[model samples]
Target: MTTLAPTEPLPRFAVFGAGAVGSYYGAMLARAGVPVVLIGRPAHVQAMRAHGLRLQTADFDERIAVHADTDAAAVAGADVVLVCVKSGDTEAAGAALHPHLGPQTAVLSLQNGVDNAERLARVLGRPVVPVVVYVAAGLEGPGHVRHHGRGDLVLAPFPQAARVQAALARAGVPTTVSDAVPQALWTKLVVNCAFNALSAITARPYGWLWAQAGVPEMLRQVVRECVAVAAADGIALDAAALDADVERIAHSMATQMSSTARDLLRGHPTEVDHLNGHVVARAHAHGLQAPVNHALQTLVHLLEQGRGA
Candidate 1:
């Protein structure tokens, strides 16, 4: 962990896949005087180019001026690259970035799923730090992002982690570099396995889903299955702690929809394959069963198929 001195200049940042999560973090960094370039869809890039990014949150609503582009080449000179693409696109994103990354460039995975960093590393042939993102956010429209609640990161310890943490901290994003990132990531995976699919299938928010009959027990079973899968994968996770976290999310972001739910609403593909589906796959690999997670994954896939019809 290399600490950034007060006199040292902030690193130039490139946010790949600048959707809701990317835009929110990039806006925060840009607002704090850090140089940020957001790579995203044409509509979002065009809108930001025309009139900056509109960031709406409970604390404040403001337009943040940041560089936005649709080209991967925009990442050429970035010192730090935040990979925010979905898990399915991790390798593609890494390959796209390979040609442009400098020798000292640090890539960080801000996407969900436990294996993203490893996948990206395989593609880039470089060390990619895994980051656990805990934020509820959504894109209201082109160039506009609405933050529901919480904006913090837990990063796997790496050479650049401290510098990245300092930069983000200056931007008002709480960051921690931990040695137990594998366990932390597994914990988050368990929570995602519990809620994301259920919320997406029901098209309801966390609080509403948690309020339904048998929903809490259902969530617990999902967590249990995920924990067993994690144990099989050699990552020890506390089931009780994960359960409490699931409950906390229901209350804390009561009105917030999961990213999967938002994706389904927009007719975009959800990351169910990476969440519950991943758990099921890993469970099978370990000669174990994750029935609850498998059921959720199957239901979400059915919903996706129905929507496509």
Candidate 2:
């Protein structure tokens, strides 16, 4: 991991997918005077290029100057490229952007899923930072991103991370770099594994989901399975801390249905494979059973297929 001097210039930003999360971050950075380009679908690109990117957040509704393009080549001159595509598209997106990445360019996997950075790294043949996104956002329309609440970043430690952190802080996005980011990612994954599937299956919010009879027991089962898998994978999480973290999600965003639920509702692909599905695979490798996670993944797949049918 390399550290940079405090006085260095901020890197230019490119967002590979100008969807909800990507557009919000790119627009925020662009508003802060960091050059930002967003690559996405043609309609979104044209809409944003013509009318600028519309940001509707809890605090403000503003339009910002961000270059929106459909061309992957737009990432060519960027010093930092954020891979914001859906988890399933990580490899293909990395491949598409590979020819444009310079030796000095830094790529960050800003999408969900714990393994996206590693998957993208395999395709890009470089170290890509894994960013744990703490924001809730949705795309309301073409070129418009509606930010529900919260926008802080927990970044994995990397050679250029501190410099990136400082620049993001200057851009008003709270940034924290941590050596224990894998732990943090697993922590988020555990929460998601417990909540996302139920939210999708029932189309209910966390608070409502938790209040239902048997829901809490189901969550405990899910968490227990996840904890067993994590331990078998050699992660050092204690029981007390894990429960507290799980409780925090119920307390904080209790009204939230996961982005996966929303994705399913909108007919977009959900990231179950990266969430609970990852747990199932890890359990297999560890000689442990993850029946709860396996059931959740299987259930979500069935729901998706039912919707398709």
Candidate 3:
């Protein structure tokens, strides 16, 4: 539980899987004068290396210069590593980072799915903090990240949680260290289970989906199913609060499409298997039924298979 002194230098950050989410945060930190290195795809790395990362938001559009590389070895001297890869790549990302991480490097899982931190920790044989990310962003091109709305993070308490929070705060990234992180993660999971598949299946945004006939009720059913599964797994979720958050998302990010929707549109594999599919599996493991979640998961799988489109 060590803390950074006020006179201490800023921690160096390395963002692995520098896609939309990673690029956004790394750009923010780099804009604030913190040293950041983004390790990502060759196209993105080349673009960033040549022109820098272009961060487009409602407030500003600017290209922030930051170190960019396609090699995992770029993480060697980083003090903090943010893992933002898709859930399917969590293990591989960890394995790739294993040899590069220094003894004092703190790893944070900024991806979706509650089990990612646990899985990554097992892979790295070190404690990995789990962060619940709430942001609406997408990649417009190789080096460009378009911010739709809201960029905040909720993290479970750990030894380096305060330090990480402090670094992000300096970069103007809103962050919280919450004792109820498991509950928060479950709440976020419930929202994803409710909206991601529906948005992807319909290729619609949150406001439109919520405005559709019976969509609100369907969302409720999905949330209820997720709550039951979470309760069985010993996490109590406030359904009313979750519903309120769903409404907030609908209003605030009305124009933003779910990441799954974007993925399907790009002909890329969606993380539906980690979102709704995870719920369905957990429900089954608990001898419970989550029909709505199962149906959504099935539909998304079909779409992924190029059947439903």
Candidate 4:
């Protein structure tokens, strides 16, 4: 893959959150000679500004220079804005950048929830493309990101999608733009709903969770409820295929903690609400009940009650 040459003028890219996902993509883009600026938490911004962003993956570990700031104004001249904040921060992040977003700037939500793009669009008064993120990463430290697994994205087809996909591909970020993004998002959500809560609650990895007795049945029920909700929401999920996919995920990242698990471990609020809670809400909207999902969401809430995000 060929990336933009240093001498070539390319579109400016801005990442709104410097968490693992944001840092990884921004660092990769910068590695490809793209002009990338990052806006996020103070410590991360300070670390990045002082030295550079540290990227650690199984294949490679290196530091790459990329502009970072705590100020939203950093997004002013960006041609593309990547929204990588947690689901709870979608609106706040969008509002923070609203006044600075140029009309031509394309927004992409690389968040967990299925509705983040829709929520961001409403807040920004513009369209925001949804991307199904398939990566396992975490903020190892300030300005440092550890990528544990996959680094690819599945995006919805749009006018600018080809350009974005090409740019990402050249940056060594595998991407696929297709019309089936809605289903793809739900599929990923299903996987999260099945594993995130269990892993987070138990403070264990996928293998540990799936090894427990009765765990398979429990995960199956969660997947069933999620599939029902997805079906109600106009996407018919294939049970067998989804289960197989989840199994593959569990095996592939057997030792990795879920994002929810990492959030809780770090004393930050988890996004179980957007994961299982979304299923509960939509299930209620459709005159259905998702007891398993409701229970998971409630458990996470209880676990996070005295904790601050």
Candidate 5:
């Protein structure tokens, strides 16, 4: 196994949301005896403060000792900060955490979108590492986070990444450091941009969504447009593998509704803008047309408007 150089004192880590992804990672680190603080909402923070973080997965359910705070002060003096907020809150999150970033602190965007790290870095005027998180998990309740499957990170290379990467791996979260991280990011982006909105808009599981009489054809079109945008952005990808990945999701998580779907159902804003909307914007910049992604974005926005009504 490739391992990162160890850092002494095991850096103080902060997670911006104690939601599903954030809680899982934070719980692992805390279990491994690394100091981890989770900054999140009042209910989660209160529950965690009283009983630590409750984590549920295929193998176990236990309360891990994680410092949970509703206060942004949870980020103070941290050596590594993982931005796990929803994509829409990226800018505000950066601003709120800016005062807490130490000179040597490393910020990593561990969210869904490909552009979050760049966006957050620009807002905070700090280098932010982009990580593609391949995990399917979510909050089961206020203080409880449930993991379904797949927990791995492919992080963009950064100066202090070796130390951070190894720590994460040691805490039971697998980490892969890659020079081709952008390719990985864009690939995930393509998959999400293609499927998430449709799943959310229809409020159907992947299997049901694609299994619709003509939905598979529409999905193929969406994937083609995303591939075109990726190519225009100079990203090399395995077309077959990408298609296979989409098929795998429909098969493996057939009963699963997307996070976007759950969010919209719960009346929370979805990250359609950063997902499909991102492909549209990037394609425009590259002088390529991404009609499929554009249409997907528009449909999701319409759904959002309907929900707002």
Candidate 6:
């Protein structure tokens, strides 16, 4: 029996680089009766193929029946491709998918960094929707994801956005398709700039940082600089409410380690260049100063260099 959405046939999805974020969303879509194929690593594919995808959220725990693969060729018939690799892997991931994607496939960049969509479009010679992911989940193990809280997405408007948003919302993924997505992406970038490096450098969570003296003020400076860069890029961020939003985010996710922190912990290269380093690069391009971001980027670079030493 073919299941149809309210107005259209549910789109087949292929989650590229299905790590924590990709696997979780794929699981959600599968649970909603949308066909999805998770293209991830060998271990994940093996586990999922054996036992299904184990998804544990705050509200529920279940194994979803979905397809899993380790090849980019698995995306052949997929209507949508969700890119979920790290910021540094955007170009390579795009290259891997270049020969596989259909002309009409809707590519969505679900990773961090505000410029990812633009980068991907350049690499693939096609448009890619930029998505701001507001989710707290991690790969607990192979083929397993433990969701802590918040599973929502804000996406740049595209021609197929209406159908996509309807499917996502029906699948319990809160979504908003808007024109303000550029600013929204910058806003999330601002948050990442403020916390990711510091967290990686200190090897601590937000609570530990909040417990430190002067850390809050330092973070404030970081956000202020990122906002300036965003303004220079013509984003016009909500300057008045920016501080409150950062504070709320820090306190709310106090126990969570920034993704950079996790990468450094695992001795993998962190996305410092894309986060704080990105602000510094753009600031220099505009002849603006971003000393705080520079310092953070430098420190993270040192950590990267010292890894395995």
lDDT of 6: 0.90
lDDT of each: 0.91, 0.86, 0.91, 0.88, 0.86, 0.90
lDDT of 6 by residue, 214-260 (tens): 99899889989999999999999875587787788778888978889
Expressed as tens digits, the lDDT of each residue in 15-55 for candidate 3 is 99999999999999999988999999999999999999999
lDDT of 5 at 239: 71
**Candidate 4: residue 90 Cα off by (Å):** 0.8
lDDT for model 1, on a 0 to 1 scale?
A: 0.91
Alpha-carbon shift of residue 169 in model 2 (angstroms): 1.1
Summarize candidate 1's per-residue lDDT along 1-309 as a digit string, tens digits: 345787898989999999999999999999999999999999999999999999999999999999999999999999899999989889899989999999999999999999999999999999999999989888889999999889999988877777788889889899888888888888888888888998898989899999999999999999888888888889988889889999998998788678888888878898999999999999999999989898899999898898881
lDDT of 4 by residue, 1-309 (tens): 334456655778899987999999999999887788999899999999888999998989999998999999999999889999999999999899999999999899999989999999999999999999988788888989988878999888777676677678767899887789899999989999999988888889998787889887888899899999999999989998888887787787788778898888788988998999999999999999999889988888877875664
Worst 10 residues of 4 by lDDT: 1-10
Q: What is the lDDT of residue 51 in candidate 4?
A: 82
Q: How many clashing residue pairs appear in each of the predictions shown?
A: 0, 3, 0, 0, 0, 0
Q: Report the candidate with higher TM-score, 4 versus 5.
A: 4
Can you write out model 5's per-residue Cα lDDT over 201-269, one digit (the tens) per residue? 889889898788977777777788888888887887777777788888888889988888888888889
Candidate 2, residue 107: how far the Cα is off, in Å: 0.9
Candidate 5 C-alpha error for residue 258, in Å: 0.5
Residue 278 of model 1 has an lDDT of 94
User: Could you give me the TM-score of model 4 versus the true structure?
Assistant: 0.96
Q: Give lDDT tens digits, candidate 2, residues 1-309.
A: 333466766788899988899998988998888778999999898989899999998778998878889999999988889889988999899889999999999899998777899999999899999998889888888889988888998888777776787668767789888888787788888889989988999898888887788877888888889888888877766656766776777778888889889988987789999999999999999788999899999999999998882
RMSD of 1: 1.6
Work out the TM-score per prediction: 0.96, 0.94, 0.95, 0.96, 0.95, 0.96
